[model samples]
Target: MRIAFVSFETVYHRDTETSQRFRTVCELFAARGHDVNCYCAGFWAGEESAFERNGVTYHAVSSGTEARSSFLLRLPFVLATASPDVIHASAQPSSQVLAASWGSTLARAPLVLEWYGDDGVSDTRWSRLATGRPGRIVTPSELVGTWVREIGADGDIVDTVPNPIDCERIHRVEPGEAVDVIYARRLDEGANLESLLLGLAELRGRDWSAKVVGDGPERETYERLARDLRIEDRVTFVGDLDLEERIAAYRGAHVFAQTADHCVFPTEMLWALAAGCVGIVEYHANSSAHELVEGWDRGFRTTSEDELAEAILAAGDLEHREYDEAFAEYDRSAVADRYLELYRTLQEAQGLL
Candidate 1:
């Protein structure tokens, strides 16, 4: 299948969880013998406006200003070039959605918008518009699947697809000694790292060191708080680890705890699990995260500092999951095959129409 990936400013702007997931998914398809092309904006991996990434072509159209980076003006040009069988984009309603709709209209290709995280509480303003029109809606969890239906999207068109993890790579690091606890996230950007540091301080010398990975705006404040908590000596702020090292950390770490409030999908938790950290997250526990984890083993909820500390210790004390109880269908290759089924279904639907 010929696929055109409608990317956002993210393709070239920064390497974020969302952008990286999109890249990984597209690359998965590309690597599996599908013809894939990525369309981005301004400076895409040293390619002019267009370049190929691992056999998948990536194009960056000029989005006028660097700030907003809306590619509304470049839609037609991108459509004319690739003329894909399907245009799958990430995120909710954005210029990418509009472009995908327009490009599909012009080329008669199906447009599949892969909605991973909820934009705010509900779908964004643009999402309503996109759903009101015709397009295939893909969600990462069954929770979002219901929401899409509630919004009057075609029930048959809505598909549930989980984010694929690099299981082989993450699990390659042999599990050895298990560290007590780990909290992985950029310390800044309202990532809720301060609370984690304070929580760690509350449990210092309990034979656990917090692996404070990732650097951010809150580094100084977090470090200072660690000192204030009188747990500075015990904590190891190892900064960010490369992909391999991160997988190793996950393999060796016991508990993975972070506070993302109530975000729909926390990618870090997925990574932590791939690395074999029993997950404890402090989400609102009312949204999709709670729903995704419903009935799933290896995950628990912690809503307060005391609860977080207790949960961390509990996870730490628990024995590592035996092979059977440990593995879920959410692994990398498993997820890729699921998405492939979705792609084939959407392509066939477009072909019939």
Candidate 2:
């Protein structure tokens, strides 16, 4: 099948979790003999044109200026050139969605809109998209599947496919001698790194140390907070590790801390769990991190900073148990196959089979 991915940002624009997931999906499809094309804005380097990587092709519609207008104008032409059998785009109202809908009709290809449970987007917007062009909606979780229906999308068109993890690549290794607690996220304001820092500070007298990974706008702020907490010497800010270093940190850590307020079973946490690291997630009103630890002995859900601190202090006592079965379905290959099934079903429904 020829697939065209329509998005405003590419993995290069921001190596974010969502963009990387899209890249993985395209790579998986391309590996299985599908002709995949990505249409999006140019990289930060501002190269506006078409390029190819692995088996997938990339079409950059805009440099770095006037993103929405540029993308809306160039989308139809790019779609005409690529002419894919399926056009997959986000349900969020962006230039990509509008253009993809137009292109799907112009090219007569089925449109598959993905709902990632972005709370910022209104239900009315999703309802409008669902009423158009006869298509399907793909969600990464059952929560999102229900969300689409509540927003007036048909249940018959919704597919619940969870986000994939590279399980094989993130398998467990024997941990190091020192009890290490790890936290990985885009150290931004919303990340709630302050909670984790406070928790670590409370345990300054303890034997365990921490490694804070990833970098963002609030890195300096977080560093200041760590200093103010007087645990700066115990907590090391290892800003953004490459793939190997990331895996190594997870594998070596005795515990992994998650304090983000709005993530849903984040891929990094899943990786840590798969690598045999004990998981402790903090509960926030709008956060779904607790849902991942529900009914699991290897994972703990805490409701406050004090609880998080207590859980971290108890990390050494928690026995190392393999929870690999819980995350097996999240493997990248497994997710790709699920998406393939969705694509095939859509194609068959449209009589393209």
Candidate 3:
């Protein structure tokens, strides 16, 4: 099948989780012997038009200093020219989805909108796409599926598929003497880093250290909070790591901690668990991460600061268990197979299969 994957930004940028996830899906599709073409904005390398990377074709829709949003105007032409069997686009930059809608109509290809949580579903374009000009809407989780339905998406076409991870890329590694705790997330608004820091501070009497990974606008504030808690000596702020380093950090840690108010799908926690790190999520109302870890015996959902501190203290003595078998449902291959199945289903619906 000839597949055209659309996004607002180039996957090479790899700046957002959407880019990384979309790249993984594209590569998997290519590996599975499907012809994959990606249409994205040309924000990098000035005026380049088309190129191939990692076995997938990338078509940049813009060249000049025009804002990335301008890609919407050019997307129809790119989609028409590509004439793919299916136009697989993400529901972001809502304008991209809007353009894909227009282009899919012109090209007479089925539009498969992959909705990664509720990022921009409230927008008018998304609402229009959800209710009008029928297409397949793929959601990553039940939480997101429910959200899409609530926002007027066609219930018949909304499909749920979990986010995929490269399980082979994750493995356990022995940690040093100290009980290593890992917290990785963009340090920005709504990060809720203070709760994690305070919880760690409560465990000062225990033999534990932490590595705070990721960089953002709120890094300095978090660093200052760590100092204020007086646990700065034991916590090291190792901002922003590559994929390999992130997996290594997860594997090398005794426990992986997250205290977020909400999450669409907690990929980092899933990765950390797959890497043999004990998981602990501070329960917050409507938090999606809590759904993944609540029932897993090796993980816990703490509702209060005291509970979070207690869980961290108990993690030191909990026997480490192999998580590969438990995490097989989220394996990259499994997710790719599901996506392929969905694509075939869409094709069959259109009498192409």
Candidate 4:
């Protein structure tokens, strides 16, 4: 399949979760032997219009990321030139989707929009029009898909394809020294670690230790909260660990608590679940974390600090596991297959298959 990825700003222009996800998908498609080309503002240090890396080709729509209007003006022509089988695009700067739609029409290709919903969406006329332009829309979770539909996209075109994880790595990495509980996510205001800390404080009498696995602006605030709760010694602030280290922590811990106030998809929670940790997700109106464990036996959902503490206690009754096969559906290969399936389906609908 010849896949064209349209993004005005690439990961090189600005390293963001959305940009990174776009790049990851392009690379995955390329690795799977699909001809993948990305159209974005040039990130390489040269006047080159095109650059090749990791079996994927990147075509510069503009010299750099500063000129958004210029990128939009030139994007359609550049994308049409590729004559791709399918056009996959990021949903930020929503107007880009509008331009890509023109390009898809010119190229006679189907357009699939990827909306992570991590980046804030501006409610403008352009955005509304862009929402309805894509033949298909993909989101990390149904929570974001609902928002996409509410913003004017047809629900029939919106699909919930989760963020992929390297489950094989989780299985290969040996567990580190066992801990009682674990919390992983950037310590930002949205971290909502206080809920987990307060819950742990309630169980001070229990001989258990926790490991906080990320660092961010709110690190000191959370550390101070732990100290104030008198659970500082029991809760170790380990900062951010690389993939393997984090997986080891998840495997070593008995419970993984997710309390983030905002999350398009609970990625770390999914990792912990795959690593065999009992998943405990706090119900936040904005977070889609609870969707992962709605009916799972090894998962628990809670609404308050008291309930969080109770879930942790209940998790102790389950036998320790090093891996869970249920989450294999979210593996990188599995998720990539989902994208491929969508692409082929769209191609078939368009008589390209």
Q: How many steric clashes between backbone atoms does each model show?
A: 1, 1, 0, 0
TM-score of each: 0.82, 0.81, 0.85, 0.98
Which scores higher on lDDT, 2 or 4?
4
* Stretch of 10 with least lDDT, candidate 3: 170-179
**Could you tell me the lDDT of residue 253 within candidate 4?**
89
lDDT per model vs. reference: 0.68, 0.75, 0.78, 0.90
Ranking according to lDDT, highest score first: 4, 3, 2, 1
Misplaced by over 4 Å in model 1 are 8-10, 42-49, 60-81, 90-93, 116-125, 141-156, 174-177, 201-205, 285-292, 321-328, 351-353
**Candidate 4 on 230-333: residue-level lDDT in tens?**
99999999998999999898899899999998998988999999999999999988899999999999999999999999999999999898899999999989
lDDT of 4 at 124: 77
Q: Model 4: clashing residue pairs?
A: none
Between prediction 1 and prediction 4, which has the larger TM-score? 4
Q: Would you list the clashing residue pairs of candidate 2?
A: 214-240
Residue-by-residue lDDT tens digits, candidate 1, 1-353:
78887766454466655676677788888888989887766554453666676887876666433633456666756776677777787653365677667777887777777766544425557666666554677776666677767665678777777677666666466653456677777776567776667677668767676677788788888888888889888667888878677767777777777675545566667777756677777766434555444565777776778787777777766676412224457776677788767767766766743
RMSD (CA, Å), each prediction: 3.8, 3.7, 3.2, 1.1
Model 3: per-residue Cα lDDT over 55-114, one tens digit each: 888877766325665787888887998888989987776667778988988888888887
TM-score of 4: 0.98
Once model 4 is optimally superposed onto the true structure by TM-score, how far is the C-alpha of residue 19 displaced, in angstroms? 1.2
